[model samples]
Target: MRDLKPWLALIFKRPGRLVMGGALIMATLLSGIGLLAVSGWFITETALVGMLLAAGVAATINLYVPGGAIRFFAVSRTVFRYLERVYNHDTVLRLLTDIRVALFQSLASASRRHRRQLTGAEWLSRLTSDVDALDTLYLRLIAPTALAALVTALVVALTAALFDIKTATLVGLVLLVAFLIATIGTYLRTRHLAARQSDCQESLRTAVIEYIEGFAELTAAGRTGKHAAWLMRQAHQVTSEQAQADTLAGWHLAGSHLLINLSAVLTLWAGFALFRAGVVSGPVLVLLPIALLGLAEIYAMLPDAFGKLGATAASASRLNRDCQAEEPARDTGAQGLPANAALFATNLAVKHPGHAPLFTHFELEVNAGERVGILGYSGSGKSTLADVFSGLLPAAHGNLATRDLVYLTQKTVLFEDTLRANLLLGAPNASETELWRILEVVELADRFAPEPDQLDTWLGSSGSRLSGGEARRVALARVLLNPAPVVILDEPFTGLDAGTRARIAKRMDLLLEGKTVISLAHGPDALPGTDRVIHLPG
Candidate 1:
């Protein structure tokens, strides 16, 4: 329950939608029960009238009222059912959108170290399956449980009015037991199994992905057959556990139904006594029993939903752990940047948590509109420093200040989207002409211009449609598109040939004329044209 608090808060954000959807569901359930109870009463009334007419005794019955009510409930059940499906499904989709947006925002704010600890497969499960579980939280678990209790109370109260307090109390007690069997009993019987099954499915997904990714290596080592067999066994175990949960849910469902039917039988038996004593009429006697039977429809949904409750909780726990929000500890000693400086750092210590400090008492200042380069070897913490300056990472101890900036990381990242869309991420309001100009500056305009879609050409996943050099240039082009006063580039010219690097570097000066550029690279050759350069010791 604690694990579900955050997600439940998100789900309840749309209170109006949830309330309306619940109303529709309630209406549908009531109409179905009303239809059944009224039909039974009408039939019993008609039978009594026919016998009275056959015995030559006058009898008056309002056929029109009962017939009209039956028609009304029948039509209402169908209409409400359709509306509930449409409205609730739409609400679920909107909630899904809200949840995904919130999840992504939390992930974006999380530290790089935390994110780095997660595998791609683990992230996928959190985003897809875990988020998917929360989307149905309102519709599946909350609404049904609440409405079932409310509807049952209403029905019990109706029984008291139609029959008597003693009989209603008896019927209510039976229903209470049936509700417990369907809900808590199912949950207790299958909670561990369901939670374990959810985890097993995730593990299997990760295993299969790893298996396919390492298939060639496994074959080379002659272990492919063994690994494949292990995956098969895991998959089979997941299926078996799912079967066990379903079996338990089925038994609980059967028990609940049996108890519900018994309640109906009890009502009918009790009603006869009341009917004989003139405490209840024949039509009223039939109505209570039929309405008791109508409760089967509501109880039918409880067992299946409660059985999966454990899995939903597990999913929420995982999401909360993975994407939990954290506020960085602010340093009171930190100072603001000087008016002329684009970036300033003083008494800075740079390192990851629980590790040796990379740099202590580091001091640096770059004036606005200065193109400064930092040169170091591959393992010299050049990228880490770049991260600190760009604020992607925090300094372990120090005062650090920077103007608004855009950073191009050491790794080239491009989405599976159009070429134009990828570039627009840097500057959303950039015109097509500006996009083509940036592409030209990066020496990619000619490469894409020959294609039919040109700017609209699809860049496959991670820009797989382009060569390594081409992808690197596309990333560089995106950074260059930003209008930030400060620009941080780490290994900006990676994957490009020397001549191409020189060409892009030459054109970069005019493009970034007014900006403060801090470019980190492995060697002097890798550094672009700079006003001054700093070299870090090994």
Candidate 2:
């Protein structure tokens, strides 16, 4: 409900668009009646030459009037769609921003121990998908739907006036009945749609993000076949569900058209019979069918829109559910840490799924000048611990807190961006010396890749073209350049050769000597043997 307010405000803010849209609908309805009126005259008027000619002229005008009315309606819809985009986008973006912020805090709030229950995809999902899920409401449910309903009602009323009061009333009654039925049917299925759509979308998002993020791991770690196969399976599942949703929506729309068509036919037949019986006039008879218009079809459409909205609502509800899965950890990590230190995490415990505990009651304290190595057996929870201490995982049970922590993962996540642009994330206004200094840390100072024109070299996604060791060093360089108090590494030297690792290690030790460090060990020889080895009690 709280999230609904901003989207509602979006509909209200563009008064000009709303008015234009309303007028278009009103005019189109008027045009529908004019068409029936003129067509009826053409049908009924006989060989009174003057009456016939007048009728012909009126017919021509009415034919053109409907087109003009449609043009206005189309133009109005276009303008409305534009405003809808702005307002809807803004509202959803705002919600997403707020959600991400909350999740960020939640990540901090959950003690460091909670980090094991999360994946890169899960975190990214919270940041991107959950917010995106709410967008379904804006795009599918709100604007077009409201406009469709308002216009349909207005057109029905105007058509009633053009025909006899009785005929008008009948037409309205028929449209109302059809719409009510359609809406009811749609309403019945809406909950199903919501649940299905939310699940499918979440799965799709999780699969895609995980595939992208773990592609390298899957390749280097030999999980590619398994991972790719799993992705195919997930994709198929999402597609199947989406196809079902679309099929249902399409059927609903078609049924609506049938209902609308039926009402139009009934109104025309009844009206014409009355006119022949000398109970009504030509204009009324013609206008009755014409008035049973494009708008009337909206009665049928309302259900589908509502159904779609229900789906979006389902998605939003699920996302919110994810948010409230465990209430926001009320503890703020910002309390006792001095801002000047490189990084800090206190009493951080990380746990994993299908486990009693990753590390029971973990405690980590890194001060101004120290390098701490986090050690654990294979699956013993080194990376999980690293993630916890760095504020990536929020649910770890024990007093989790960090100050100025920067995480350098084994896989260097570089966009298809330039050398300078990538570095800009750390320090946007870095000078030449700064860049050179950063390059020095990674031992890439004098060696330049000539493939890219200059500092604006576009290293492809995940720094693919570069060797794994080079990419790892590049990420390390980025961390070195950032003026942060703490540097956290999760097997940052994974793919590096022994010499390269040793060289980079020496430079890092000197540069990070005064800063707190937490590096997760991969092999027994991983890292330069830090000040402390955190053990995982199996």
Candidate 3:
């Protein structure tokens, strides 16, 4: 239950919509009960009046009031049903949007290593299935449970007034037990199975995706049969859990119905004693019994909802765990940085969590408006150091400070959007001329200029439409467009031929004249123009 606190707080943010939707649901239920109770009263009165008139006695009955009420209840039931569907569905959509936005923001702030621990399929489950489980928390669990309790109390109170305290108390007890059977009992029976259902689904989804992705390799190795057998078992387990949950919910639903019907029977039997004592009229006797029976409609949805409550809590727990943000260690050197220094580092240590330090007690400083390059081979800690300097990954022990900067990571990433949109991420207000000028600097203007859509051409997923060098250049163009005081480029000239790299490197020198630059590459040929180069010991 504690796992649900954060998500519950988020859901409660839209109290106004929740209140309105609950009111509509309440009205719909009450109208349904009223319709049945009043119709019973009207029919009994009509029959009694007819008997009296036929016996050579005169009788008078008011048809207009009950008839009008029946009509009103009938119409309101339809209208409120429609309105509830429209309004509540809209609320669910808005809630989904809120949840997705918060989730993405949290993911953005989380440690990259933690996020990388999850497969792509697991992340997809969190975004789609896990989020879906939460979006309906109000409609499925909260509102129905609350409205059922309230409506039951109202019916019991009415019974007390119309019949007698003793009868109403007995009827209330029966309905209370029914409510528990539908809600608490259902949850208890299905909790373990339901809680693990999401996990099983995620496991199955990951298995299926892995199987498809590795189908060719496994087939070539003559191991596809074994992998497929494992997938079958995983899928079967998921199906078995679902079936068990459904069976439990179904039994609880039937039990609740039985108890409610028993209450109606008790009401009828007790009404007979009251009628013989001339304590209540015949029509009134039938009314209370019919109203008791009407409660079955509300309790019907409770068992299924409670059955899924365990799953919802599990989903919330997973989301909360995955999105937790760990604050990085503060850089104490920031306040003492020299005015002319673009970057300052002291006693720096670099490593991933649970791994030995890659490099420690290292120090470096770059002055403002200077070009400095750091050289290291493949196995060295060059990229790890780059991450620490850029603040993507925190250092084990370090004091570091940097002026505002833009870092072009060693990996190239571009969205499946228009080329213009991709570039705009770096500088949203960059003009067309500025864009063209940057592309020309990277010698890519000619490549895209001949395309049908020009700048608006689609980049495909991760810029799949472009070759390796072209994609690398597009990423470079974006980083260069950023107006930061310092620039960190890790293997920025990757995939470009030597001739192309020389041309771009020369052009970048003039373009970056007024900003400090820190570039990392394996050797001097791979580096751009630099005032001085630092080599790390192998």
Tens digits of per-residue lDDT for model 3, 286-352: 9999998899999999999999998998889999998888787857334667889989998999888
Residue-wise lDDT of candidate 1 within 177-245, one digit each (tens)? 999999999999888898999999999988888888888999999999999999999999999999999
In model 3, what are the clashing residue pairs, if there are any?
Answer: none
True-structure lDDT of candidate 3: 0.92
lDDT of the structure predicted as candidate 1: 0.91
The candidate with the higher TM-score, 1 or 3, is 1
Candidate 2 residues 1-538, lDDT tens each? 3434543454455566455544544444444444444454444433233476767754322446545555665665566556545655665565455555655565555444354455667666655655565534443455445655565576567656554566556666766666655565666665576567666767777887777877888799998898888878878877787677666666666676676777678777777777788876665565556545555444544656666655555544544444443443424255665555444445555565555766655555565667777666677777676665665555446565566667886557876787777777677778977887878877776555444455676678877767777677677777777777777888878777788778878887887767777778755477764877765554
| Residue pairs of candidate 2 with colliding backbone atoms | 110-394, 111-396, 113-349, 113-350, 113-396, 114-395, 114-396, 342-485, 342-486, 343-486
- Candidate closer to the true structure by TM-score (higher is better), 2 or 3: 3
Q: Estimate each model's TM-score.
A: 0.86, 0.63, 0.84
On the 0 to 100 scale, the lDDT of residue 459 in model 1 is 96
Residue pairs in candidate 1 whose N, alpha carbon or C atoms collide under 3 angstroms: none
Off by over 4 Å in 1: 53-65, 329-339, 346-362, 394-399, 419-421, 428-458, 464-474, 481-483, 494-514, 523-529
- Candidate 1, 60: how far from true, in Å? 6.0
Q: Which ten residues in a row have the lowest lDDT in candidate 1?
A: 326-335
lDDT of each: 0.91, 0.62, 0.92
